[model samples]
Target: MREIAVVFVLLAFLAHSAMGEEMVFFADDLYKAAATPELHASLVDPAVAPGGSTALKIVVANSGRVLALLPTGIQGSSLEASREMQEELRSVDALNVVATLTAKDPVSVLSGPATIPLLPSGTAQPVEFLVQVGEGAEGPYHLDLRLDYEHQIDVRISAGQASPLYVPANVSEEITIHAGGSRESFRADYARSELWPGENGTLTLVIRNLAGPAGNCSARLLAAPPFRASDQPVSLGYMQPGDLALATFWVEVGDNASVRQYQMACQVLQDGESSAWSSTIPLTVAVEEGQSIQIWLVPLPLILALAFLAWRWWQG
Candidate 1:
């Protein structure tokens, strides 16, 4: 009887030792590396501009150990041997996986904390984070992620003889982020505040390049109600950073235009690319009503009579 009891204890000890081994395998292709610490993450991209969102793929693996003992000669049964100690694995409860994001200097965290329900030895899970950058944020930025979870591991050595072990997992990863630099926008103003009807005038605009990498700039004027631009689209060539270029547009006021101010719109494009629209500005031009036609006609007949008399004298 003593020998049999010792034998049973030895078998239980061997089984416990075999079940304690666990290996975690992460997909290398899916891992994103950060610039600072040489660690692996789910995502680290520089293409994220101001007010953008990015997703991270967080996966947990148990190394294909989901089964119990199988025939030795059968292929792919070695991992199944661990299942002998975990027959109640399928009946175990689920776990809550929580993730949070934090951005370093120059980068602001808009919104984040994507959570999911994960199971042991299950498929990969994904989390997302939203961030925004400041206009003056000319920086090399990065993000830090914190992952926390509560998992309940099940171990069953025999029928109706199972024990539950609760474990908490926490991990941290860093990701890189980026944003665009500031640039000076184009602005336009009228040369004169007011003009008479049927009068031709010029409008002046200043294109400022201030720290932006834009070239081949051009602008088009859009007018409405009694205002017409002689040059619809004016071309203003390249301007280097900290340099300003002057643009002028010839415009005319309609003869019958009202004496009120009319609003005009201007659209700018860069690099001679029609598909891209740089900026839109508003301009105001005022037209004053002209004198009555009768006032001007009073001298027209006198001038004609003088001309006729001159022609009669020549004939004489």
Candidate 2:
């Protein structure tokens, strides 16, 4: 009988401890329902670039409060497709007024020596910024968002952190175009490589003039095969000499597309005339896994000639 009583007492104490512990969860601030949409865009704009830079535009709206001690200067969550997608959101201080946006105290809201009072309910007045969409990012990315919050329950007897990520359905599509080249030089030679289906990588465009001659140039990427049939065409803008251009794109298998022997090419432009285009970079996009595609291959004739010459010299 005493053992039963002891067990009951232990369970009661544990239950009470758990109940009083605070659990932080995210809920859309009912008052600012309209702001939620804006917030979503702001949060994502900095990190989104798809189907060339021409398709990029910044979007912002304040959604409901994402409950938690939202960590600052961290990529909350994003889909990873573009070669490099970067986004930043911060409220260093309020614009109209001055105050520290990420102040230590929940009640403290000051932007640059300007103090902004809290909302009527003592809610943390948040100032968020979703600034500047990245340029020329291709393909789609669903950034991983920290959808949940952290809290302590059971009268602070225990604490835990939670990351809530919603399952993603294809929300947006992206297509990026870039020239193949050595990271050191966006020269014409390095840009010639066949891209296969299921192959994805960054295209770096380095536009340089004749060194002495001053001129304007444009770098363009045309979609072919698997990349061509995507929803719509992605256009790369005209790049000037010293134009630092980049785009990330992906290649998915198409109905008729082969993992072997696909075609894509690169074209360069100066003034208005196009440079002698690079060789057609041939590729073999695979499906069921037969062989790794190599966009760059040695010419058969060159290989045979070299082998013959080596044999003759060895005999001598």
Candidate 3:
């Protein structure tokens, strides 16, 4: 009978020990599963003008919070447990964050990636990036936003406790923005579209105001190799919407210019405004080969008159 009782007592002790171990393991698993981070991102200003540079503002926020209680079987006093709970709650904070902005085609990110040392829970941070919209870009465009960071996932407060565990995380988002507005427009017309090598001619540029009214508007020609311009900038004084103005430039073709079409650019600007507008008007002109017979024919009339006079004298 004594031996049976001792055996029964030993079995009960073993069962209690096993139950405590199981509870401790369950508590650790609960802590790891409850602490998680959630991040949200949005653009502050969503409208931008084409052919211009603007600052893109983005706001990043942390919405994660502690919603579960600490499980039982973890050994700690009431005060100690409160401290541990607070530390666990901070596990949702994002650390060492980096945000990169990207776009396709007509939109370009001019600034580098933004970095944040730490972002606390229930808080937000604003980041600004300089971006450029292409000259031909219009309508709506999408920009890619990526965020990389690390956050605490688990914390150990009992025996054999070490540092908190941090895991790497990433988030991807898209920002949409409208990129179009009223801007200056121009068109070019050449008075002499065709020219001969070593020839001088005139080029006429017709300017039409498609945007708002402007004062002291002027236009200039930008000539490249094989083409030379001797005219200065022409003033249009004041221009209203849908108004048309003409600018003429004296162009000289190089002697050894190739017999092909060449492209040139025209620049337009406003006099008293801090904002300067530019448009690429690809004005093309063809250079043709000069005929030797046509050159000789120019002096044929004078030569014929002199020969006729001399022949009459000789005949007399």
Number of the predicted model whose lDDT against the real structure is largest? 3
State the weakest 10-residue window (summed lDDT) of model 3.
291-300
How does each model score on lDDT? 0.45, 0.29, 0.60
**lDDT of candidate 1 at residue 53, scale 0 to 100:** 40
Residue-level lDDT of model 2, residues 35-127, one tens digit each, is 011112111112222222211221211222212111111222223211111110111111122221121211121222222232211112323
lDDT of 3: 0.60
Q: On residues 141-208, what C-alpha lDDT tens digit does candidate 3 reach at each position?
A: 88888999998755666553545667788988777665653334644433335455578877777778
**What is the lDDT ranking, best to worst?**
3, 1, 2
Residue pairs of candidate 3 with colliding backbone atoms:
none
RMSD of each: 35.9, 25.3, 35.5
Q: Which residue runs does candidate 3 get wrong by more than 4 Å?
A: 1-33, 158-162, 182-316
Q: For candidate 2, give the lDDT.
A: 0.29
Model 1 gets an lDDT of 0.45
